[model samples]
Target: MPVIAVLALDGVPGHELTGPGMCFGTAARHHPHVAYELRYCTAPGFRGTGSPAPFRIDTPWGLEGLADADTVLLPGHAGFRDEPEPEVADALRAAADRGSRIGAFGTGTFTLAATGLLDRCRAATGRQYAAELARRHPRVEVDPEGAVVDADPFHSAAGVLGGLDLCLHLITLDHGVPVAIETERQVFMQLHAPAGAEDATGPAIRHGTGPHSLGPTIRWMEAHLDHPLTLNDIADHAGLTVRGLNRRFRAETGLSPLQYLLRARVQAAQRLLERGDEPVERIATRTGLGTPANLRHHFQHHTGTGPRIYRTAFRSMVAALTWADGKHAEPAEPDGPAGADTDPGPSGSADDRRAARRRT
Candidate 1:
């Protein structure tokens, strides 16, 4: 199992300290195969204080714990504006030298910057402190607007949600998109306390300008992913000519309109695969891929696996996870059972079910 060492400092944000665990723990719980050992460490003789809630903490590990960690995470603390302890800086430097991925959350960027590891690397801190970070560390390029900055081997995030994004991203790097997507859904469920509801992120483009400029258009695309939406249709919805739409869409999101739509469709298919034993043909139609072959081609291209294998793998993983947790794996439900096949297939007719059954 990979080891992730989180450095707990005085006044560390409670949310940041636990955010990575929520993501990694959920991945482990759901998939079991993508397990990680999360370790919490602190500086020598450290008696840390939790943020917002005045409480004391005692960490189990010291700076030595970072020596062999696969990744090191630094959560923002009360004294982030001040220089990090000399021993802490040295430990971080040694970890970097040994090729450990180091990340800072929120104002923790200041601590990382002080160590000189982020010099000449792009980093992100809280927007309110962006100017101060740039002024203090002239060599570091500070992105005030970005939620997270990925400077290989070294990363930084803006705030709590940014920290969550970074944690999911690291999981994605370690495992794959499938595991990451499921973990994201699990985190969303915990945040919203809702059952079987879609997360707000919704498999859309993550890196983009604010929704103020393209909210309606993006929401429309998300709502109509099951439709055979063309460029003209999207442009019409946006009330822009093709050329203008292309320009503006590219600006709002890094992808072109069709590219974004296709990604959304593929992601939607992934969720279906992870959540249930839906047939590939039905999933393809529901996700607007139109045909199983098309779904397979694009799904493989984007996720590096076929839909059938993806579903089978998820089921097997969940079963293995259940067994590992000292629980018996639930028996599989009978195929096409009443209420199980209630979801209408592509054609909204009984023939659609027959066709899906045949294809499956």
Candidate 2:
């Protein structure tokens, strides 16, 4: 049985803390042998605060939980004014060093990123916080997409229920896609969430000239992953000759334009697979990978799995997608220090607070 240690920090969001509890609990109950034992740990002091401790947490599970766990889950809170207390950050770093798969529910991703494990890794976080997560951790590839973001050892989500996606994905990774799909059928009463990139950071491309020459163009390619876009069209928009675009794009983003486009298409195709919608052929066309044969060509070439099975195993949200609203979503500093409270936290009983978000 894999023991999942969920860290309870001061001011941790109740929903963020509880979402994993419910889904993983369901997994354990249904799966049995591969069941997960969920542990909750608190920080040093809690009960002394006047009005709900800001996080609605009166008691935390303490330091010991980090030592014995298969997976470590970090739930983000609004108070991200700085990196966690030294001991807390150390424990998080230690967990990362131990080969334990590290997870962050929301802004909690920032915590894990601070541990240096996220450098150059792709990931996701709460919609309200996508910008900051990217800016604060420049080395980490923070997906502006929605719902869920994942890069192996590290996984994150956009809003409340994203925790469900994370747990379901873990099941797939641990057991098999078939088992995960079955579990989703049992819990979601729907097919598994789409695979590929999430839209959490959907369209949330970082603006400005620094990478505008490069980042903006790549961002555009990512968005059109589902639409039909030609290299010439992309070059025109980027204001470069096809050859120039190819050269500059590769030098700047480390990928040729077509290569990057293909990657985005594959990622989108994965998400489509997870959504369980549209026939594979249409999904391929929609994502610009084109035809079952073409999709198979790229998907098999890149991921080693055909589209259907890949969706069953690894799909989450639209990969690298920032929601449409995120484009104009309220602007924030894009970086909050430890203990800084930027957004509103959850409230009510633990269960209600956890369920408050339907699919944020």
Q: What lDDT does the true structure give each of the candidates? A: 0.71, 0.62
Q: Which residues of candidate 2, in runs, are more than 4 Å off?
A: 46-60, 189-360
Write one digit per residue (lDDT tens) for candidate 1, span 212-232.
Answer: 466678768977888989888
Model 1 pairs whose backbones collide = none
What is the per-residue lDDT of model 2 for residues 17-123, given as tens digits with 9 covering 90 to 100?
Answer: 66677676655544433467788877665332121223454333577788878898887654564777788888877877788888786667777787777898887
Residue 160 of model 2, lDDT score: 47
What lDDT, from 0 to 1, does candidate 2 have?
0.62
lDDT of 1 at 353: 16
For candidate 2, the clash count comes to 49
Following a full C-alpha superposition, what root-mean-square deviation does model 1 have from the true structure? Answer: 20.3
On lDDT, the leading prediction is: 1
Which candidate leads the pack in TM-score?
1
TM-score of each candidate structure, all chains considered together:
0.56, 0.51
